[model samples]
Target: MALAGQPNVGKSTVFNLLTGLSQHVGNWPGKTVERKEGTYSHNGISVDIVDLPGTYSLTANSAEEVIARDHIIKERPDVVVAVIDASSMERNLYLVAELLSLQTPVIVAVNMMDVADQQGLKIEPEVLEAALGVPVVPMTATNNRGIRELVEAVDELTRDEATYEPKRPEIREDHRAVLEELEHLVAAHVPQPYPSDWVSLKLLEGDDEIMRMMEDRLPQETWEQVHEILKEHEDAVLAVASGRYDWVGRMTRAALVRPGVGQITLTERLDRWATHPLWGLLVLAGILGLVFLLTYSLGAPLQGLLETYVIEASARLAASALAGGPSWLTSLIVDGIIGGAGMVVTFIPILIIFFAMMGLLEDVGYMSRAGYVMDRFMHLMGLHGKSFLPLFLGFGCSVPAVMGTRVIDSRAGRLLTTMLVPLVPCTARMVVLAFITPIFFGAAAPLVAWSLVGLNLLVLAVAGVVINRIAFGGERAAFIMELPLYHKPNWQTIGILIWQRSLAFFKRAGTVILVVSVVLWGLSALPTGDIETSFLAGAGRLLAPLGALMGLSWQMMVALLTSFVAKENAIASLGVLYGAGSEAGLAETLPTIMSPAAALSFLVVQMLFIPCVATVVSIFNETKSWRWTLFNVLFLLLVSFGIGILVYQVANVVS
Candidate 1:
């Protein structure tokens, strides 16, 4: 069985409810699109389920569409569950129309019935199932309603005794003959597992993937003959779409009852301010400020407790346990491994709060409004408005930000957005700022932190404008997105999201942070267990001249270098370099060694520096070109240092 739906139709929520923690997530083979697979078992029946990418249609215009259609055709899941928004059934049915034409068994899952009810819309699932000649199950996935029924529906369809014959859509009267003629011509040549009639429709629709596949497989004369029909009837694609909409119209008229005129919905009342040109910006700002305030107020204290009790106590216990071991072994376990990675591990509390807040906003359907509000400003940078959604994801993490670019249909727009995402000051960078800003600026920490975030976005905007002109010739793509109706957020869904993201962070601490810390400690302990006379000291001094221009000491320079491993490692590396017994010890030591001017410059550079290794790898994977990847790294390096020097020199003049 497979789950498929348009974007924001509660498909993923349903998947989460069914699979829970028993899901495997990874990329599609040789593609950046994510794939999620899980097993469902109930009543002595077991089934494998796949969650396909959210796409508006099955046309081969985007990688997502190709992946979705190919999976249904090639892999051929036993049951294809089509999840649709009950409130927007007319628009959602277009994909179902395409799916029915594929000769597969489809179960229509009418999700978000609660949202439909709130809007005063009523849909009869029985009428819909009868009209479409398929099973229809009404559901509110977020509320955990109708899930068992949906599962039961799936079970019934998969049984050997079960049978279904769906009413599929067809081309217009004038083009039906042409479709049949094409189908006849390719009847024998149509590849295995691909229905000849469906291939014929795609050929008339000028589907690029199908055209190329047929062009290679068909004889020259047959190809030219097929091409002539397509050339003569160029509007056949429109005819096919009109037919699908005609089918959808019939289904809607039979089952959907619209609200009375002048009836205002909750989404409508809220969008008046949420999507406003001016007020929306204020609302977005206030919301962001609230998120940060929550992070500092709630996450910070929890982080401190973890640091004080868990990390510090663990270090002491480890040191005591290894007391009789070799001196080098003791230092390696306690300082190298625990000291470095443990500091980053303490960031879990802060990351959880931040992730939970983001998940809540997204689940409640505000993210689309946020994107709509930013569309105008995004256009100024030659970006499609939809690019804001993925760029916004950068606030949580860059990996998803990069992956989220798949939502953008335009190639140039997606690439440009990917490049800009690294500058978004993700939670890791925010965590570093949260830790350092208070120690440096005291009561003005919040103000300084806000200013640094503003600075990163400002630089990102300037870079986008310049790069758009030089590389992309300032070509802008039009934005089109469907804003999901606002609904009550589900805490279970939000908790699961936080758990997944927080688990990823913990995995990083165990792998990347652990390796870097151990290696740095080894470098600091070699030839003698004294950090001052060890390998790291010689390396830090090598960059002394460059450090002088930015008021950064050699230790600060080394910390910045280690940050490329992981942004959180900057603090951990400092602890290792300073030999701070605890986070408080490092905080107290940092101010005495560096002046306020130097501290400010270091923070500036840290915020603007090249992203960590994982983000770099994601960029390379997405772009598939070492040239662009190297360009991004070098561009950020120059910008970070140039601004760092300017800030340091100007601060000195003012002080």
Candidate 2:
């Protein structure tokens, strides 16, 4: 079975509810669009369900649309569940209308029925089912309601097969002959798995994917005839959409009852403040401050406990167990892997808290309001609010932020946004700031942390404007994003998101951080047991002059360099260099070695440093150009060190 829906229609919630931890997530074949597949057992029958990308239509306007359309036509699933918002049936039924024409079994899953009821809208499932000639299951996916009935509906369709005979939409009456004529012209050349009638409709509607395919396959005469017909009825696209809307209108008219004239929804009442032009920005800023505040207040204590009990104890035990072994072996186990990677792992609690808070915001639908409020600011950089969505993802990880640029329709806007995404201070960088800032700044750490984040965004805005003017010639795109209704957040959804993200972090720590730590430790231990006389020391001394400009010693400089491999590696490298196996010891040691002015400069540079290796590779893959990737790295490098030197010099004078 396949799950299909427009964005924010509870499709993901339904998928999660059905699959739980059984799902696998990765990119689509040869595309950055995410693919989710999982198994669900219904009444002793195991069904493999693939969740297609959320798209407004099946037209090939974007990668998501192409992926979803190809999956249904080529890798046909047993059945496709068309999930739609029950409260906004008129808007969502268009996707359903498109799915019905695919000749595949489609079950209309009317999700968010509770939201519909809250708005005083009533929808009759039986009436909708009778009108559309397909199975219709009303559900509230967040509440886990009607899932059994939905599953049973799918089972019935698979067993009987005749229950899915849908009343598909037709072309407008005036253009019916044009569609039939084109169908006859290209029928013989239509590719495999692509229905002749569907191809004809797509050709008439000027669907880019179908037009290109038919253009290549059809004979010259047939192609010319099809093109001529399409040229003559250039308004056929409008006609086709009009037909779908007509079908949706009839079905909705028969099944849906509207509320009173003056009825107001909970979403509207909330949006008054959440989406206000002036107040919305303040709300967004306060919410961000609260998130960071909670991170320190709630997560910091737990992080300290792990460092004191878990990491420190593990390092001590490993040293004791290996004391009788080779001295080098003992140091490698105690100081290299455990001291470095183990220390980095202590910040897992902080990341968990941050991820959970972000998940809660997304689940409750405040993210869109943030984006809506930032739309004007984005316009200043020659982009729209849609670009902000991916940039927001950068706070968690730059890899997804770079990948999320696929949502933007304009290529130039996407590329410009990609350049600025690296500056968003991901959780890895945030963890480093969280750990080190408190050591030097003490109680004012959160204030300084917020300032660093704000500085990065300020740099990002300036960079966006500069890049947009120089490379992209300052083109702007307009967008319309639907704000989902604010509802009680589902803990299960937030829990699953936190689990997935935290698991990813731990996996990276175990692999990348582990390897880098051991390698750096070897460099520091070689030729002598003392790090001061080892290979790593020799290398850091080579760059000591540049470090002096930034008011950082050789050790701090080495940590910044190591961050390119992975942002968390900076902390791991620092632990190994300073030989502090516990956060307590490292925290004490950092303040004594560096003055407040230099420490502030170091934090500024760390926040603006080149993104980790994974994010760099993603940038290259997304842009498909080494030129753009190299430019992004060099641009950030210059900006980071330039600002670092200026900050250090000015603060050194002030202090």
Candidate 3:
């Protein structure tokens, strides 16, 4: 069985409830759209379910539509279950009309009945089933209301071998005449398995893919006749679409009872401001500001407490426990393993706050509005509106941001968005900035940090235009995203989201961070037991000239070099280089060793430097192009250094 629906119709919720933990995700064959399949046992009968991409229609205007349409046509699943939103039956039935045209066995699963009832809309499933000639199961998928009936309907349809013919919507008489002629022609020319009537309708609708296929298969004279007929009835496309809507309107009137016609709900009223051009931006800024304020005000204190009472005390105990062990072994365990990894672990409080707030925004459906408001801005940077969500996520982490590019249908759009994501100044980089800013600017730290964020966005915008001009040259794809209704956030869902993200972060800390920290420790603690003479310091010396250009000292250069492993490692390197035991100690020691200009330059460099190792790997994984990955690293290095030098020069002159 295959499940299909429009976006935000609770299709995924149903899929999760049925599949549980017995599912796998992968890319569709030769497409970036994700394919989800799972097996479950219902009524002692095992069934396999495939979740198709959520699209508004089956038109071949986007890659997702093409993939979904082809899967249903080529795979020929046993039953196609169309999930419809009960609150918006007319809009949801558009896809159902297309599905019926394919002559495939379909069962209408009316989801979100509770939401519909709350909206004062009464639906009659028996009437709907009689009208559409398919089994209609009313369900509130979120609460698992009618899932049993849905499954029984599926089982009954699959078990019965009777010939099932779907009732398709009727088009206008003129359109119907043209479709009949074209259908006869297509049936004679096209092979079996290609539904002739569907192809005929698609041809009338001016589907480029179908036109290409027909042109490839049909004889020249036959093709010329088909082209002449299509050219003669150019308005048939709109006519056919209007006819489907008419049929849906009739069906909805027959089966649905609305308490008030054209009543604007609370969601619509709020969306007016949330999606406005100017007001929406203000709202977004306020939300983002609140998120950061909450993260810093709440998380900073907890982080300091952990560092002081937990990590530091534990380190002292470990040192005391390892006093009689070999000297190198003690240094490795205390400084290399614990110190290196613990530095990263300390920031979990802030990350948790960030992730939790982001999860709340996502759960409440405002994130989609953020994307909607930013669509025009994205177009200015040669991106679609849908690209904004992943980029917004970059402020939290780059790994998932890069992975989120899968939602973009255009390959060029995905690549462009991926390249700019690293420039968004992730939470780890924010930690480094948070650590350094106060030491240099005192009470003006927040303003300076805000300035750095503004600079990052500016640089990202400019880089986007430049990259789009040089690498991506094509028509900008259209972005149509569904804005879900806002509801009270489910704390359980938000907690699960936070737990999953935190788990991924901790795993990285344990694996990549632990190994890199050990290796860096070895490089800094080699022969003679002096960091100045160590291999890592020697490597930093080689880059001293470049660092000098940016007013950065050799020690700062080493710290920046270590940051490539993980952004938090930059702070760890600072502690090891300056012999400062904690972040507070480094904050005090940093100002005395470097001028204010140089300190500011160091922070700028950290903000714009190459992404950490984990993000680099994610970029490569998403793009599968070593060339683009290497280009991002090299391009960012130049940009970071250039910006750092400019800031240093300006700051020196002002001072």
Q: On a 0 to 100 scale, what is the lDDT of residue 48 in model 1?
A: 87
| Candidate achieving the largest TM-score | 3
The 0-to-1 C-alpha lDDT of every candidate, in the order given, reads 0.87, 0.87, 0.88
Put down candidate 1 lDDT per residue, 165-202, tens digits, no spaces: 78888898889999988998888898989989989999
Per-candidate TM-scores read 0.62, 0.60, 0.67
- Tell how far residue 638 is off in model 3, in angstroms: 0.5
- What is candidate 1's TM-score against the reference? 0.62
User: What are the runs in model 1 whose C-alpha is more than 4 Å off?
Assistant: 1-236, 239-261, 385-390, 396-415, 427-447, 565-596, 613-629, 653-655
Clashing pairs in 1: none
- List the candidate 3 regions with Cα displacement exceeding 4 Å: 1-243, 246-262, 404-409, 579-593
Per-residue lDDT tens digits for candidate 3, residues 1-655, read 8999999999998899888999999999988889999988977888999999999999998998998889899989888999999999999999999898875699999999999999899999999988888889999988889988988898888888384555678777767878898887777887667798888888999999999999999999999999999999998899789878987988898899987736877788889899999999899889988987898799888888888887778788889999999988888888887777666677788879988998999999999898889888998888888888888778877877887788788889999999999999988899889888888899999999999989999999999888888888735667567889999999999999999988876785457667877888899888767899999899999999998987887889999998987787899889978999877898889888899899889989999999987788889988999999999999999999999999999999999
Worst 10 residues of 1 by lDDT: 504-513
lDDT, model 1: 0.87
